[model samples]
Target: MRIKIKKESCTGCRLCEQICTIWHYKEINPKKAAIAIEPHFPEPGIFEPKLCVQCGICAKECPVDAIHLEGEAYVLHADECTNCGICVEACPIDVLYTHADVPTPLKCDLCLKCTEVCNTGALTVVRRSD
Candidate 1:
């Protein structure tokens, strides 16, 4: 499953980011969240929500073979990661981010936790045939 974001409905609340961090890390840190909200000022009420589309670009570009496809999701092997930032650069949508407190790169595993907390219906998970 991949997340579909309705950019117009987003409020830049960061609730999705907060829920993701709390669900995965058991902490309240937005920096650790897999999803990110990029605010667009001067445009007035425009927020871009970046999320993983499960494209597998990061997996294919991992020189160390740290990223692998598991079923429909891409899983990261942190032990094999070299902090090369290759995956981060390989992401077309700029969804992948380097971990703040670790050497491994952080990408969404399509856990759907962020969708649960999205009150504005801005985020939803959809299954892809490919």
Candidate 2:
């Protein structure tokens, strides 16, 4: 499934980010979460919940074929990755992030946990036909 973000509806409550990090890493750190709620100041109520849109560009550009589509989200196979950082450069929207502790980049895996806790309806899971 793909996640649809309604940026305007975001309240910056950060429930999505919290749940994401907890589910993936068993922590409460938002920085390591796949989803990020960024604030755009001087723009009134603009909080963009940045995430993977599952465009498949990262998977297509990976030289080692480390990345693949899990429904509409991209899933990285850590063993196949070469740490070339090619996929990071290849992502058109730049949602992929690297952490100091993790070998591979962090991104949404479509666990649906974030969408389940999104109180503002900013995040929604969208299932595709293919």
Candidate 3:
């Protein structure tokens, strides 16, 4: 499955981030959430929810090579990662966020939890055709 976000529909509610963090980590911290909504400041009243393009830069740049493509998604082996920040620098969209307290980075797994709760219909999951 894959998620496609309609940027125009996002209301800056940030409910996607909240639900993601809660579902994945059982917490309310937005910083830990895989998805991020960065406001377009100076333009006022505009928000952009960053979507993971599923690009492999993070996996490709891992110094320990800890991030691996497993079963259609990049899964990070936190234990194996040396936290060299190479992947963080490689992400073109800046979706990868450094966990303030943890050595590992956080990103979307295309789990679709955000899709289920998005009342705006901004998020969607579709099967990838082989």
Best by lDDT: 1
Q: Summarize candidate 1's per-residue lDDT along 16-122 as a digit string, tens digits.
A: 98998788779888898888899999767599898888898899999989888987889888888888998899899999876668567777888888888899989
lDDT of 1 at 16: 90
TM-score of each: 0.91, 0.89, 0.89
lDDT of 3 at 9: 80
TM-score of 3: 0.89
- Count of steric clashes across candidates, in order: 0, 0, 0
Q: lDDT of all the models against the reference?
A: 0.85, 0.83, 0.81
- Model 1 clash pairs are none
| Candidate 2 lDDT | 0.83
* Cα lDDT of model 2 by residue, 1-130, tens digit: 5778999999898998789889998987877787778899876758998888888888899998888876556788888888888888988888888878778888678888988988778988776753
* Model 2 Cα shift for residue 27 (angstroms): 1.8
Residue pairs of candidate 2 with colliding backbone atoms: none
RMSD of each: 1.7, 1.9, 1.9
- Comparing 1 with 2 on lDDT, the higher-scoring candidate is 1
> Which portions of model 2 show Cα errors greater than 4 Å?
none
